[model samples]
Target: MWDLAGTLPLPLGVLDREGSTVIVGLNGLRLLRDGAWKRARAEAGA
Candidate 1:
């Protein structure tokens, strides 16, 4: 997740590479604002 200000990258949860799974709660996901996500994705060219 990213902060609403889009200046910091917040830790949303954990990822298990071997298991190919991500552990994130609903609240954590909600912490990410749409604008921040869109800005980040655009910057990353994703």
Candidate 2:
């Protein structure tokens, strides 16, 4: 995730495991959401 943000030059704020305190760029959020969705779908299929 950090790597993705780095490549995209996305802004970020890390507070903890939860993202409630985090601030991210639109592209970053989209990428993160897509990654999470893919992971969840794979796990579900497994």
Candidate 3:
């Protein structure tokens, strides 16, 4: 098993009055085997 903990060195928030409800941040994931996982992508739309 493994665990990951990180901080977003910049500002990130979910504003309500500004008509925004999503904030993006970065995280690093490491596995015990040998592979690597980076840049988890996401999209928002109606």
* lDDT of candidate 2 over 1-46, digit per residue (tens): 7655665333433343236535445446766677788988999999
Per-residue accuracy of model 3 over 1-46 as CA lDDT, tens digit each: 1112334232332233233422221222233324332222222221
Q: In candidate 2, how many Å is residue 26 off? A: 12
Best prediction by lDDT: 2
Q: Of the candidates numbered 2 and 3, which has the greater lDDT value?
A: 2
The lDDT-based order of candidates, best leading, equals 2, 1, 3
TM-score: the better of candidates 2 and 3:
2
What's model 3's lDDT at 40? 25
lDDT of 1 by residue, 1-46 (tens): 3355575533432223323443345446755779878887899996
- Give the candidate order by descending TM-score: 2, 1, 3
Look at candidate 1 and tell me the lDDT of residue 30.
59
The candidate with the higher TM-score, 1 or 2, is 2
- Model 1 score (lDDT): 0.55
